[model samples]
Structure formats: structure tokens, C-alpha cells
Target: MTYFVYILETMNNKTLKYNLLVKQFKNNIYTYSLYMLRNRMDADDATQEVLIRIWNNIDKFNYSAAKSYIMRITHNLCIDFLRKRNLLINRELEITEDIEESFGDESTESNPYLVMQMKIATQKIKEAIEKLPENLKSVFVLYEMQGMKYIEISKALEIPINNVKVNLFRARKKLQEELKIYESE
Candidate 1:
């Protein structure tokens, strides 16, 4: 059963609207938090906190760039959570490079050995990213992985465009240097 208010929009209507918004951005928030926090629990908590922030600030949402606005809120919430959690990996992430995880029991669809090798390479990439400082990591995550433009990142992070560009440049250089070991293998 559904209830409707006589007013233009009811409380239920507001709930539905926010629910839709959450559905649209939930995955993005979780993924960003996961990469930043490197822990499922913290990522989940950050996503919930960000969603709560969105709910509380629904009226303040900028209709023009709602996606960016929501993402900005998410980014802020995630960074805050990370800072509170000692700004370091409190829990070790159990990244699996197992052959079975890459290839199922049947293993007929793909080569298990190649899949395992790829998983190892992927783990190394994650390790390199994790080595980045918080500032560079945030910028790298937004520009490289999240695909935000420099201006958008600047707005979201409340930093200048030039700073965003500089951080991204430094981050890329650091990553290149850190991952150079793989090239020799």
C-alpha cells in the first residue's frame, strides 16, 4: 500500500528521490572508498556516511552538476573517514592472486596459469598505488581511475586546477618509478 499527501511532494516522495540518487552513485562511492581505504568495512562505512550526508543536504544539491556534487560529497566523506582511521591501512587487505579465483573449477574457458599471472600483476599495481601519499593518492584516484577532469577534481576537492594538475603529474611520475621493478622481471 502507498500513501500520497495532498501537498506537491510528500515525505515518501522525498525518500524515493533520495533513494534513486543513492542507487545511481552507491557503486561509485563504494569503489572510491574501497580504493582509498583498502578495507571493505571502512569502505562500506564511508559509503553509508556519504549517503547520509546526501540525504541531509538534499535541498542544497546543485541540479546542474548533480553527479559531480554527489561525487564531491562522497570524496569528502571518504577522505575524512580515512583521516580518522589513522590515515594508514589499519587492516591488511587480503588481495588474492590465486589461480582458482581467476579461473573456476572447470578452468576450460581460460588458461589458469595466464590468469594467475595477470592477477599477480594486478596485485603489484595495487601495491604501487597504495604506496602513494594521501594527497597524491586522492588526486590519482580521481583523475586516473575515476576519470574526472582537472577542473572537476579541483572543484570537488576545493583545490585549484593547477594544483590538481601538479598533483596528478607528481602522482604519475611516482607510480612510474614505483612500478619500474615489474619491467625488469
Candidate 2:
């Protein structure tokens, strides 16, 4: 009877920890997947698979490195998904509608011109990000958009720290050049 109670307690504690970890990283996983996969449906599927993998491997990984571990899984899953579907060519840019809707407030709604300009600017930036090469895009998304540190990006992408720095630098330079062209137009 005592052993049964101990088992129950252990299971409950593990479940609680798993829930917290999932909540903390779910959005990051989905966003990374979305940027990598370039499709909402595929991203959703990838996110679900990541969550399941996390739960399955909960006992195997250290909680201290959970972020990198989860992100590594997400990155690999997205890559596999892309490869399986042969989706490298003709990739369409998926500008998130959430960004546009988030700009809607009492003040912004009052100025239709401002709203339109904001959406256009947001669209252009998203398009620029989408146009980046895969290496640059992954580094950009993980480091800049996902707010991950250099070490974290290195771990997640399985790249050297120096490579992470170089890729991020190149991503920023390319984005700047792309956006500059848009500004000129």
C-alpha cells in the first residue's frame, strides 16, 4: 500500500513538471516550426509531434537543458517534415495574421492609413524573413525571433557557436539589404 502511494506521488510530480515545460515551450516550438516548415498546417502537426516526443522522453533528458533539448527536437522534426514532402522548392511565404490583428487597437483603428501601412510593413518584413536561405533563416528565427542566446541556438541547431554567430550576422545583413530594397520602392 505504501509503495502504491509512492508511485502515485511520483507520477503526479512528473506530470506537473511535464505540463509546465510544455506550456513554457509550446509557442516557441510552434513559431519555430511555422518559420521552418512555412505552412501553418505542417507547423501544427510538427508542434504536436514535438509535444508527444517531449512527453515520451521526459525521463531521459535533464530539466536544466529542457529548452535546447525541446528546440533540437523541433528543428529536427521540421527538417524531416520538409524533406519527406520535398517542400524545398516553390516555398510560399506565410505572413502571420496574428501580427496584423495585434496592431488593431482603439488608437490604430481610428487611423485607417496607419493600420494599412503597418500591415504592409509587417508583411514586407515577414516576406524578407521567408526569403532568407534555410541556414540563415533557421539561425535568424532561433536567435532573433525566438529570443534564444548564442549557446542555445548552437545546441538547438547542432552547430558550432562560431557558426551560430556567423549565420546570425549574415541573416541580419541579408534582411537589411532586402528591407532596404523595399524601402527604396
Candidate 3:
């Protein structure tokens, strides 16, 4: 019947959209989760959950605002994961395990001394970021690392745009102070 054919076509279209959405945002979700949860396994679980939620609510969300919507889901899920594990406070991230992945591929330089220096600098920066307060860390990671805009972060974290700007500023200041201290040592 015509109705049956129409239903099948709609389902196919939805499936195609969902696939494209996943392809676009999966890395972002996983990266956010990795920073928030600070564990590979937990990040993986959170990414999977976010993807599942996106699929389930595919028809309900506006694709125009899809990035914020998807990131909000990811942020919430990461918070829940942290709370469930009682890591909301006194959280310590193992920076060594995925440091290369978190930052990027290892330097391809031929100079061993330069590569070593780069790795040390990267590790120090990562440690400083890990030491930031949760509020600042969230803002810093979302803006600097995830390439999210102020408005996008505000919507995703359910904070005002001004708050996003303030938090990002504070995060940067704190990171600078931390790096300064490291340099002195």
C-alpha cells in the first residue's frame, strides 16, 4: 500500500540522518567524555550512551541546534558518571594512558631532544588542566580543546553566555599560573 511505502521511506531517511549525525559528533562526544570522566572505559560508555540517546530522540531534536543538544546530553551523562562513582570531588586523572591521543599524535620530528621536550611540556600542561576546579575545567576543555563557541558551551552546560566567558577566562588564568609555577621548578 502507499502508506506502507511512505513509512518505509521515512524510516530510511531517519536512519541516514542518524548515521551522518553520529559520524560528525562521535569524536567530540568521546573527547568530552574522556576529559570529564578521565578514564578510557568510562568515556567509552558515556559516548555510547550519548549516541543511543541521540538516536532515540532523533525526531525530537532540531538538527540546526544539534551540536548543542548532543553536547548537552554528553555533558549530563559525564556528570552522572562522575557522581555515580563519587568522583565529583578529589578526582585524579591518569594522564599517561591516553596522553598521546588526548593531545594528538606524537611528534614526528627526527630530533629526539625536541620530541622529548615537547612531550614533557605537553604532559605538564595536561597535569595543570587536570588540577583545575571542575567548573573551570569544563569550560576550558569545551572551549579550548573541543573548539566550542561561548554560546554553544553556555547552551550545552546550561549556563549563561557571560558565565561561559568568565569561566573560560578564569580557566586560562589558572592554567597560566600553574604553568608558571611549573616553569620555575
Candidate 4:
């Protein structure tokens, strides 16, 4: 009963509905800001800004297009923040192939070596990801971590889909190179 009313309020743009909308989008807003800023304080600030904008503009929201609308807002805000910092933000990202290969369902109980190897590989991959250039890192996080399609990413970044593909390819190449060095060491 309460849940249904909340939804109605949200749809009808009541004061209660506005709060409900904020509750629903809060996690996504925080996560998006965190990914863009890579700092908790800045992410917090971004989240507040997004919430304020959403609250003030709730009347403009169309239920059918709400998801895409929110994402566009987040994407634009991130780009604006980056621009203000004079950063050449890239949206490409690479994941370590070796980590992907090792991700099969192997039981640690059956083979201790497999468990240890998985742990080490996971840590190494994380380290490698952190070391990647910002462009590759962003692309990797957006595609792999956030599970956004290349087309969606292209729209968000205002880049061509082909550029998204190329950036992903280059990011993968960088990851492969880093993995090779790790293996050789």
C-alpha cells in the first residue's frame, strides 16, 4: 500500500514523490559521481548537486524516458567537472585477459593452488587497472564495470561508436601488455 502510494506520488510530482525519486536514484547518483571524480568528497558534492538539479526539475521528467534522462544528466555533469579541471577525459578501458581467462568456476576446496592463483591474479589485475591511462581506465570501467554498451557509451561521451570500439581495443592492448609483463616476472 505504501509502496504504491510512493510510486503514485513520484508519478504525480507531489512533495512526497520528489523525496521518493531522490531515494530511488541516490545510489546510482553516488556511484556515477564516485566513478567520475575518484574522490569521496567530490563524489559527495556531485551527488548533492545532481539531487538538487533533479528535485528542481522534477516537473520536466517523463516516466518513459526517466532512466536515460538521469544518465544524461550524470554524464553531462561529469564532463563539465572534467572540463573545469582542464582534463582530457578518455572513456576507454581495458581488462586483463589473464584475469578473464582464470575466471572459470574452479573450487578452492578442490584445489588450493587454483584459489591462491585466482587471488593473486585478481590483485594484479586491479593494480594494472589503476596504472592504466585515464582514457583506458574510464572506458574499461564504463564498459566492463558498469556494463554499458559501446553505443550507450558513445552517446554519453558524445563520441562515435567506432571511436568507442577503437578506444576499447587500445585499452585491451594495454592490459594485455601489462599482463605479459606480469607473467614474465
The candidate scoring highest on lDDT is 2
The model with the greatest TM-score is 2
Q: Tell me the deviation in Å of residue 75 in model 1.
A: 2.8
Alpha-carbon local distance difference test for all models: 0.74, 0.84, 0.83, 0.67
Pitting candidate 1 against candidate 4, the one with the higher lDDT is 1
- In terms of TM-score, how similar is model 3 to the real structure? 0.84
Model 3 Cα lDDT, one tens digit per residue, 103-169: 3444553565776777788889888887788789888998999898999899999999999999999
Q: State, as a TM-score between 0 and 1, how close model 4 is to the true structure.
A: 0.59
Task: Answer with 1 or 3, whichever has the higher TM-score.
Answer: 3
Give per-model TM-scores. Answer: 0.78, 0.86, 0.84, 0.59
Candidate 1 residue spans exceeding 4 A from truth: 1-12, 89-91, 94-108, 182-185
Candidate 4 runs further than 4 Å off: 1-10, 14-24, 83-127, 179-185
Give me the runs in candidate 3 sitting further than 4 Å from their true place. 1-12, 100-109
Order by lDDT, highest first = 2, 3, 1, 4
TM-score of 1: 0.78
Q: Write the per-residue lDDT of candidate 1 for residues 110-147, one digit (tens) a residue.
A: 78687667767777777778678777888898788878
- Candidate 3 CA-lDDT value: 0.83
Instruction: Show the colliding residue pairs in model 1.
Output: none
The true-structure Cα RMSD of candidate 4 reads 7.3
